[model samples]
Each structure stands twice: as C-alpha cells, then as structure tokens.
Target: MSDQHVYLEEVFSSIQGEGIFVGVRQVFVRFYGCNLRCSYCDTSETRAGNPVICRVWRGCEPGRFSETLENPLGVDIVADLIRDLWSPSTRHVSLTGGEPLLQSRFIRRLGERVEMPFYLETNSTLPGAAVDVAGVIDVAACDIKLEESGVEDDHGVLFKRSLETIEIFNDSDCLVFAKIMILPKTTVATIMPAVTSIAEINPEIPLVLQPVTPHRSNPERLIEMMDAAGRYLRDVRVIPQTQRVLGVL
Candidate 1:
C-alpha cells in the first residue's frame, strides 16, 4: 500500500441512514472535502477546511465520541480503528465525505489494508476518481443531484458527470444504486432529467428518492415523482433519512 494519508472529519459507528442500506450498522469514515455545495447539505462543515483532529467514536455506544486522533491519518491506522469499532452486525465501512472521491488515492490504499467491505457514499460527480477506486468498492450509493435541490450545476456538466460515475460503478462488480435528494419544492420536471439518465444507464438499477430531512416533506410530490420514474425504471422507492428519525449519530 502507498503511504498516502487522508484528511478526515470523523470516525464513528452508526446506522446507515441513507439509501437502500438504511438501518444497517456501519463504521463511517467521513473525509473532509467536497466539490459541490447543495443547499440541503447536512455536513457542510466538512466542505470547508481540513480538520486538525478527527473525532472517533471508539466504543459500541452510538454517538459517544470519546476519543480524538490527529488528522492526515494513514491507511493502516484507519483500518485498525475501523476493526475496533466494527461489530458483528456491521454491514460495511462507509467511506462517506464531503466527497470521499476527493481523496481517491487514500481510499485505494485503505481498501488494500481493510478487510471489511467498503460502501462508498458519493455525490457521483467524479467519474475519473471513481474509476481509480471502483474495484475496491463493494457497494456504492451514488447521489443524483437535482437542480431544484440547490445543487449549483448551471451547465448540467456535473449532472452528466454524475451519470458517468454511476455508469462506472454499474460496470464494476460493486452493487450500485442511485439516490436522489428530494427537497420540498422538488417536482417531477425537476427530477425527470436525472431519472431519465439513470434509466438510460440501466433501468434495473434501484432508484431511491430520499426526502430532505427536517423540512416539510411532501408525500404527494414523492408519490408523483415515483410514478414518473416508474415509466423508465423498474424499482423506485421513497426512503427518508431513517437515522435522523432514530436520533442516532
């Protein structure tokens, strides 16, 4: 493995809150950078500066972050910590971010060192980087960013890149799925382009519509969006942020 180090925000054990893997236990290794700024983002703090220290939830207790480790952590060190936090029911070690693909090299090395499965939670805008780490990924929750959700993709370049990234993962051995964040104002027209593109890639790929948390969710809108998706896709489901409802980290 290479001696590459990664800037991380936190290392914690928590329920998989988003996507099809919701409620599954995971060891979350949150990296510290992102290329996009979505208005409904919950972890925007991760997008700013490199954290000097990473808060680690060391025990089985959820949200009980009792330890801190110096930043720019090595792959071996991160692997060890993940092993320590992993439980019998732990489904995978989630390489989440502000955009984990930003540190693709570091993730490649971590994949080499860590025995557990890697679940990548990414904003699918980095197909090149996705190519670099795709072999190592076991499951991918690729976000399909919608314009109505305040994703700043003016020219739709990022949207195209997102589809490309998803395609890359779909071609790999990794189990891949598309996740779209639905805001209160998100309409069928707002999501059509993304939904149609995903269908083009492979309609069989499961599509998850996640309502943005803490907002007044429109159930009717979600139903309409799902109906629209059903024309091009086979499996479309509405799954909100269950971890937020469970009051876990």
Candidate 2:
C-alpha cells in the first residue's frame, strides 16, 4: 500500500450501470484496495494488489495497461487525465475503487480540478473520511451492506453514518443515492428494518436495489432473492449488471 499516490487497477470509459447515473456514460477510475471483505464482492482481487489488465465490462476483453499515477497528483496533471478520458458524450466522472474514501484528500483535490460533476462510489463505512470531501463531490452513490453481505449491519449504525454524510451534501448541489445489494440469502425479515430505516431518514433519496450478479454465485437463486427484496422495498427495483447484458465495455 504505497502512500505517495493511490495504486489503480484500471481506468476506462463505461456506462454508469448502477444508481441514479445508471446508463449514463462516464469514465471509471478503479483504485486498487479496500478495507472490507464482503462475501459478495465482485472485485475481490482488487483488495490485495494492482492487476495488469482489468476486465472492464462483459464480453469486452480486459482493458490494456496504460500509465499508472502515484498519489498526490498535482491539480494540473489530474485535470489532464480527466481531459484525456473525456468525450463529447461523457456526462460525469465516477471515482470508484476498493474504497475511494481511503484516498479522500487526493480525491478531493482531484475533484476541485475538474469542471465536470464527479460521482463517488463508496462502501459508506468511512463516514469521517467521506465527510472531509463531501462538499467537493457532486454525487455520492453509497452502498449500505446488510448482514447478509457478511458485514455487520449493527442496527443500521453504518447506514446512519452514510446518511449523515449524505446530509452534508444535501445543501450542496449534489445528488445522493443510497444503494443496497440484495442477495439470495437476504430475507423479508432482514430487509424491512433496513428499508424502513432508510425511508425514515429520507424516502425520497432514491434507493437502488440490485440483485447480486452471477459472478461467483448461483444464477438460479437470483430470482428468489429479487422476489423477497421486492416485497419489502417498494421504491426498489432490479437492475442486473448491464455490462453483462449488453456484452460491451
């Protein structure tokens, strides 16, 4: 874990397949590491070290290597990278990773350099870190993992912290979307409390309930899981991995 600059696994342009930005074309910056070991993680390899080539989307061959950047990039250099990735159809930039909040300061500085809106995809476990740069970000797509994800839900304490960070961005012109991944093992009993809690916080915040992709798990179980999740989360809808469906990068 080098501290000078963040290690990146891949960076490519792709459709924003989840959250409010779903289907929107954007540049994805996938950083190299993470703190959590959720059972359903699709990017499990990202936790340890950088990979030579990254499989960006379904059917698309692994994206080839480009130059890697060290952390603490100057605002100008960061701006240039954004420009290089930019296209006429690009709507915004998505700063994602094993956990982007881990590099909050650098991400914040990078966000300051870009003229376009920036979106952050985070696990929402690091509220303190996220709050530091919440003001600079234009949108936050925070994931609130349930106990079924093999993570501790703790009566929604982690969820609450994420909401707190969302509130910080409420007054800014930024949009915040809370995402919950529903797995085969998740139950009605388990989901209601969580959905109710989110509804209580702000029902209008746009909750995205996604069925766990058929990455390492049984695909047959997805329908059952979606059925259970749908019963409780009325505002929720299913969005499978679009990249998988489209066969594109």
Candidate 3:
C-alpha cells in the first residue's frame, strides 16, 4: 500500500451510533478490510473484496451520496473530502472500518493532513498496528469480541491480542474505551473476563455495552451484564446503533 493512497469503502458524515460517543456528529471515513469475521458484522462488504470506487456522500445528509471517487484514494484527497463534510458540531473524523488498524499507515498519513481529531473504531486485535497509529488517535473505541460473537479464537489468542491493543492506546494520549457487542445469547460469564481485564488496565476507562442492532437484547440479561461490569469498571453505559434508526450510513 502506498503512503499516499488507501482502500476506502465510503466517506460520509453522521451521528456516532455506537460506544460512549453515541449521538456525536462526525465525518466517517470507512476504510476497507478486517481480520475478524464476527457473526453479526453489519459491514461485511468491506471485510474482504476491495472496492473499485469509493462513495463520498454529499454533506452530512443521509442517503445523499451525490459524489463518488475512484480507489485507492489519495490521503490528501480524503482529507479534503472530510473537510467538505465537516460541520461546526462535527466532533472528530471517525476512522472506522472492517478494521481501521489494518491500514494503520494510511491512518497515520491521513491524520497528518486533517485537523480534526482521529477517532479510531477498531476490533482491538492488532497491538502492533495500534502502536503505529496511536500517536495520532484522539479517541480509541476498541471492541472486545465475546466467544458468543462467532469469532474463531479457539485458544483466546484474539482476546489476548485485544487486551494488548487496548493497553497500547490506554498508555497513549488517547481516550481509551472498551466496547463489547452484546447478543441475545451473551451471558454474564462471557463478558466478565473482558470487564475484569479492562478494570485491571484502568478502572477509569469507560465501557460501552452495545447490543447488536436489530436483535433486541433481553432487558433482564442486559441489566445483569451492566451490573457485572459496573462492579469492576467505574463507568458503564448501554448504547445501540442509532445510525440505523436514523437511516444513515
């Protein structure tokens, strides 16, 4: 991959619908590719195949993508598109993806050309990649995959990697938070280890329990999970994918 270019799925502006930053407006730059194939992944299209053209939405409106750019996109070109999509209330440039850390080099370069803080949304399974881009990241929304999420981590290697990645960003200047996607089947036993690990790292780090979209979590189960997390972590909140509710990208 060239330092000047990156594979992108799309560029748009919308409210952040996950993590503790839910409802915050942002310019979302969706990079392509991912390492993990979670059962409930909504962005599977970006996980494997490379896109031939990148969809750059017009302004911050949903479903108003009046522009399209060819891939691989130039870093400066993406910076300009982000600037064009930014509003006074836009909090940061959301560097999201199938897994943004896969293209950490491009993220570092893009961060150089953009003024807004880089908010990285990652799977938290690549510690080395995290190091490469941690300096430029302002907010790290690291995902903790549960066994029930259909991620094939037979020996817990992926979970260990996630913890390492989290530690990297936590030690950096970035605001680090752990986000666990809860399914209807997600139990207290499955989530406790992640919460414990995060607490061991820093009890001050916020934890966001995002119930996978379209699959309503059992209220009782969600409460139990929150209570369990609260005992270890200082801050815990339940958020959902509101972008789908608002019909945005």
Q: How close is every model to the real structure, measured as TM-score?
A: 0.95, 0.80, 0.96
Could you tell me the lDDT of residue 34 within candidate 3? 90
Per-residue CA lDDT of model 3 for 215-235, tens digit only, reads: 867888888889999999999
lDDT, candidate 1, equals 0.89
* lDDT, candidate 2, 224-246, per-residue tens: 54455455444565566677676
- Candidate 2 residues lying further than 4 Å off, grouped into runs, are 1-4, 49-75, 152-157, 215-235
Q: If the candidates were sorted by their TM-score against the true structure, best first, what order would they fall in? A: 3, 1, 2
Candidates sorted on lDDT, descending: 3, 1, 2
Candidate 3: where are CA atoms >4 Å away?
59-62, 153-155
Query: Alpha carbon lDDT of residue 216, candidate 1?
Result: 78
Model 1 alpha-carbon drift over 4 Å, by segment: 1-3, 59-63, 153-155
Question: 232 in model 2: Cα distance from truth in Å?
Answer: 9.5
- In order, the Cα lDDT scores of the candidates are 0.89, 0.69, 0.90
